[model samples]
Each structure stands twice: as structure tokens, then as C-alpha cells.
Target: MELKQIIQNRRSVFPDQYNSKPISKQVIMELLEAANWAPTHKRTEPWRFKVLEGETKINLGVFLAEKFKETADKFSEFKYNKIKRNSKNAGAIIAICMERDPEESIPEWEEVAATAMAVQNMWLTATDLGLGAYWSSPGLIASIGEFFTLKPNEKCLGFLFLGYYDGPNPERTPNPIEDKVEWL
Candidate 1:
């Protein structure tokens, strides 16, 4: 598909059927490369990624299980196990983060914004490649950001779950431009 078409076709699909089939490393690299090209301010290029797969996926599940258990909402063992199991089924899990800049005059929010843009590039590229991708914050685990052992200046933003989708892609519903556009 054309690049424009791919971008328009992308969707956020959760409860996705993450099949056991694996994706090629070459395709994964291509998607990351797309993320690397995202626009940045002062060339800070603050994106950082940690790729999780195989045994590492299971480890993350266990960690998430423990983290959520601490809260009073009390997610059930079944729901907790579902996340653990689904995580393992994904072909790859990418943790997207940003490293704060102390010397630069730009605000910290912009750095995180740039990182988020990069993630959009990744998601679009994955769509172009016919892959199913879901970006999850898992706030319960991410809120304490320090637990990830980020560099003194780094912070976790979100994670992207990538894999082959076993379901149909839904059509996009167009919104009228006037609703969001301003005359100013």
C-alpha cells in the first residue's frame, strides 16, 4: 500500500489476537528506523527503546502482575494472568521513553512530545507492513517510572505491543474538519 494510505489505515486495536507466529527481525528494524526519523527540537532526539521478547516478555508480565497487585482496585488473578499470557504471545514489545535534557532551553514536555511522535511513526510503519500494533501505557506499572531504572534524566512514556493480527481491520470514521479547526 502507498505510504499515505497506510497512515490513514492505521488503527489502535486492543484485545488483539497475538498469534504465536513471529515477525522477521528485518521488518522490526525497518519499523524502528521509521521512528528514528521523527521530527525533533534542537536535534535532542530523546527516544529510547527497550525491545522485549521470548523469556523477557514473561518477566515483564510477572513484574506487571506484582505492580498492579499493590493497588486497591484489585485486578483479579484471571485478568492479571490474561495480560501475562497475552504479553508473551506478542512478537515484540517496545518500551518507548525519553531522556530529559538539562542543558537545553527547550521545555521537558516537548521532548516527551517528540518521543510520542516517533511512536506514531512506528505505529504507521507497522501498519504499512501489515502488522498489528498496540500502544499501551500500563500506567500502574509505568507511574513509578523509577522502577525501570531509567538514567537519572530519563523517563518512561509508554510501550508498543507488536505482532501479527488475526482479525479484520475496521474502517475509519471521518470527523468533520470544522469541528476541530479554528478560524484564528
Candidate 2:
């Protein structure tokens, strides 16, 4: 497919939409490789990905469910159940992290933007490969360090929940680009 077509077709397919079939490691590697090519300012290359699969995925679900139960000021049982179920349902979860430049050579926001572009690349690749994916940034990621080890310079950005789904998701219609543009 063409680039424009791939871009237009790329949509956030959620956990409930994902079938039970597992996406192979090699395919996941392909997406990661595409992520590696994302443009970086000053070559900081700040994105780091940790792949969670099988029992690890289930463990992550349990961790998030328990943490949400303990921390949310107004948590719902429905939300808690969904949080736990989502992780275990995924074919894989990529913990997206950003490693700050040790010397602080660049502004922090630049590093963050670069990391996001990296995820965008992976998302596009997944779409092209006929796989489903979505980036989920739950409030509880602030506490993820408790569940997973991290370097002093590293922090959790979010999780990329990816899998293979069997059908179409609801359509997302974007507003016209012209409406947001300004000419001086």
C-alpha cells in the first residue's frame, strides 16, 4: 500500500478488538526497527522499548489493577476490571521510555517529541503489517517504576498495547486541516 493510504488506515485498535492470536517476535522486531529510524534532533535517539509478552503481560495487568484499586480517588470496579483485562488480552505490550540526555544538552521537550515520533513510526509499521496497536497512557504509569526497574535517567512514557484483531474499529473522522491553519 501507498504511504498516504497506510497513514489514513492507521487507527487505534484496542484490547477488546484484538483476537487471541499472537504476533510473532520477528514481526515485533520489524516494528521496533522502524521505530529506530524515526528522526531525532541532535541524534539524541532517546526512545527505549521493553517488550512484555505471555505471563509477563498478565503480571502487568495484575499490577495495574491492584495499583488502581489502591490509588484512584474515585475508581470504578468496571475501570479496574478493564485495566486488568486489557493487558492480559494484548499480544504484547511495549513499555515506552525516554532516557534523558545525561548532560542535559537538549531541552527535555525535544527528547519527548523525538520519542513520540519513534512510537509513531512503529504504529505506522504495525498498520502496514496488518497488525493492531494502540498507545495507552494510564494515570498509573507514574507508579510503574515500582513494578519495573528503571535507570536514573529513564522514565516511563506509556505502554504500546499491540495485537491482531479480526474486524474493523469505529471510524475516526478528523476535522479539516484548513480550519486549524493560519496565514499571516
The per-residue C-alpha lDDT of model 1 at residue 113 equals 89
The candidate that wins on lDDT is 2
**lDDT at residue 180 of model 1 (Cα atoms):** 91
Give the per-residue lDDT of model 2 (tens digit) for 62-168: 99999999998998999999998999889999999999999889999999999999999999999999899999998899999999999999999999999999877
Count of steric clashes across candidates, in order = 0, 0
Off by over 4 Å in 1: 143-148
> Looking at model 1, which ten-residue stretch has the lowest summed lDDT?
140-149
**Candidate 1 overall Cα lDDT vs. reference?**
0.80
The sequence of per-residue lDDT tens digits that candidate 1 reaches over residues 1-184 is: 9888887889875534767678888988998899999999999999988887788877777777677676638669887777776677789888888887768668998998899999999999988888888988877655535345778788777778888877678767789989999997
Q: Which one is best on TM-score?
A: 2
lDDT (0 to 1) per candidate: 0.80, 0.94
